[model samples]
Target: MQPTPLATSPMPDSEMLRLRQEFVDASWWLTLVYALISSALLPARAWLLGSWRLSDSIIFLFIAGYLLAFGQRRRLGGWWRDSPPVLVMMLGGSTGLLGNGLLGSGLMTLIFANTLVAVLFGRRVVWIAFLYTMGVVLLAAWLYASGRLPPRVSSDYSSSPLAWLMAISSGTLMSFLVLHFVSLYRQRVEALHERLRVQSEEIARLAHHDELTGLPSLRLARDRLRMACHQAERQRSKAALLFIDLDGFKRINDSAGHEAGDEVLRVVAARMVEAVRSVDTVARLGGDEFIVILSGVPDARTATEVAQKIVAAAAAPIPWQGCTLQIGASIGIALYPEHSDTPEDLLRRADSAMYSVKRGGKNGYALHEEPRTPGHTCQPC
Candidate 1:
């Protein structure tokens, strides 16, 4: 059977949708984590500072936002679907801006957010996120320079246990994000490589096998013939080449149609394989023609016996479409070191012998007889 071509297009819509849903679910988990972290920080800050600063209200707002986003995550659609990367990046950037500005965890948070976007979305979305981040940093820098915003003293929180806790928590989450996506990317690459390796093997198989009968093609047959001859030479034994032609195949093709003829050929090929020894090579030489290489044969007589089995196999009726299709095999065998030691000579002489059988009425086997003079002749077996 002919192999179906491998797909080279993007994933199907169902798969794409499923992947998007997974990302959506992951986003919800991220939101829930952020809310929990913020909630924990609120209590830690109240205990450390002895009183809640007014800026603590901003933390409350952020915590509420995270919780609300997490709750409504399943309902994310329309605008949420189209621009989740933008929404997520902005949320992360906002947290960094209000918590410590870009000088603190804000810068790191923004970078991680961009990386997250890069993983889920394409490069285009990542580029847009980068531009947005740069714009925010520049605006914040300008405001601080112009005295429009109060100067954030890094030393104010740098030595605080609360600041350290926040840093450790955020860093751990960001690192997990980086590692998770990195592992996913690696798995996808490995899967792709495996698919390519399998496809390469399939392409090689199709190249050297018959599409119709799934038997070895002429190229593979020739390679086997050469190896058989070489092995026979080393072992000081005999090898034989059998050339087979299906009798009345043209008549079947013309009368019943090519489909029926193909079925017949497939059946014949299977029968021929069953008739030969497991070590022997049975190959198709295209359209109603096949070749068998019998390795390490004792004599021409052994080759003849194998050919006789093949003839009996082919002579059996093949059932197709509620009708019995009758066919026969005309076999010609030539031995190595006796007829000719070379694969080329053995194939040529066997083919000549097969034609001799066809000319002398088909459905029989012949042994190649080398011409003593100019003309060639085949000795019927």
Candidate 2:
């Protein structure tokens, strides 16, 4: 599923840290490469160009900055949210400033475009553009006043030196004002986006995971199982659904506070995940109950093996709150079609068998079979 804007925002905290470390390690190597090439190349170009202007060097720096930022883009996100938008504004500003020195015409136009990009992008893309626009307009205007503007040629009376300078100078001043206004608008938009991003992340985390166990909740589990079942069916094979219930969960919760009970659940959830096949699915259906879906199981034997593995894993006493605590689970095994056809039906059969095991004797698994009732929970006819 396509993630919301916030979900796709900057890299996750863990990934961000890893990339930061990698960037630090790799940065020096890239610098050394650039240094080696520039030591040999930049001097030659500067000598041949006969003393390059600051703007000329600025262009090269802008390109290098873009490359550095772009290298991290894939890790961050490619669309809508990567890179500081302000930096882009600054980049455009630099381009226009450099253009003024090299191309010498339409410097005002370049600065204006920088403002446009800045105003358009907001926080993730703000101030950099604004700074460049301001720099070009004020500096260029000052330079023009000092006779830095190119002299106008008069073939027609319409072309006058005073008029040409005034018009270009006025245009630069006007664009700077426009850029200033754009900056304010962008700031407001950035604030709104930040608010939305926070809310989006909060909602996504709550929806996909259990509050107590920190495992995928039933809604998310259903989606995963649906996909796994589809794959198993395509291969004309089978999958196992194990309904897991902690044997004495209620007594532990009632005796030791809910906090201690929660820890047990967390411990059990972790073990369940560790016990299963890598292709299996583990989900919490709330309050001391869990489910495991094992894919590509060939028959009841395979399903039985998985259920036994989980029971073994759960039987290991979990270390919690600096004390070892005992836990046992009753599991129900239900194979696809052998138990029932649909996801819900399979889950119900597995659940029934789990209850049977829980009642007959705790800490064991019962293979699901048709209940002795017509249309009972839609068990196989």
Candidate 3:
């Protein structure tokens, strides 16, 4: 049998939300990383090619200001939702222009840009980014070929040491992003599986246990009763089934309202559980009706003593709304192999005995006995 679970807190809509948020925060650091490396390489590229512009310093300031303002923001919504894609595009476009177009080491930056965009946005936006980047590279190539743009001091910049450095740095950034995202994705999947497992167990618990008092429902009680009878038959020991009906419960509901009645039932259920032995089973069959199964009882006398305890426990006044609410228990007992060996027959006999107690008087226990006449009838409670 599965153990009872404590109350569970509400689950988030999707476990992936946490991973996405982490990805957002990480994207900022990634952009800052690219900014630092690319900014450091700017002076080397200018000295190697002997072409530097005022726009280079302006772009560096823009990258720094952008990172300082929004790099640490963890939220994924509002104005900054599209910031990652824009940042990647800026880095990719500028690198491709400064390096000798896509024919040189700038190709790696374009690839890294598309990769980041794909992860942050979806496939469709990545396509748009790719086209936009290709357009920028093509326009720069056309201007340089048409003699509109000035030629660099060194035409062999692609064969220089600076190209190798840029390639290694960009490759490192891409590898780190892929590995980190994969690790985070695995954690999100594990968390989702754990939530599903807990939900399945809670669903099974609700099926077999009463929601109100957290006691075993009729289904679980019946299964336990069958097990008890089978064990008693094998060992030649005895087991008792006590059918309990709460008396004066209707009067309490009628007078104090259902909330008070519910409180009273909770208190009574707790008391009955305390009154029984640890090996015994207490179940709530339905509204105001309960059952107790006792295994390894010596005889009817011992079963009667347990039933007496249940009666006294149920009879205790439950305080509700600054007033005492009185209720009582009417229990009927049927022993295994004495009344009947089968669980169904034992329960029927016990229920019959309980109705008999209701007919005679309320708030008492009775044992199953042979009816004196065939015309006996019971009224609806």
Q: Which residue ranges in model 2 land beyond 4 Å of their true spot?
A: 1-177, 187-198, 370-381
Model 2 lDDT tens row, 155-250 = 331354433443354354445456545454465456556866887877797799876666788999888777768878899888788899987778
**Local error of candidate 3 at residue 306 (angstroms):** 1.5
In model 3, state the lDDT of residue 151. Answer: 46
- Residues 198-239, model 1: lDDT tens digits: 777877887899878889999999999999999899999999
RMSD for all candidates, in order, please.
Answer: 5.9, 15.2, 6.7
Give the C-alpha miss distance for residue 118 in model 2, angstroms. 19
Clashing pairs in 2: 85-124, 85-125, 85-126, 86-125, 86-126, 86-128, 89-129, 90-128, 90-129
Off by over 4 Å in 1: 1-25, 28-83, 94-104, 120-176, 254-259, 370-381
Model 1 alpha-carbon miss at residue 170, Å:
4.5
Model 3 alpha-carbon miss at residue 248, Å:
0.8
lDDT values for all models: 0.75, 0.63, 0.76
For model 2 the TM-score comes to: 0.51
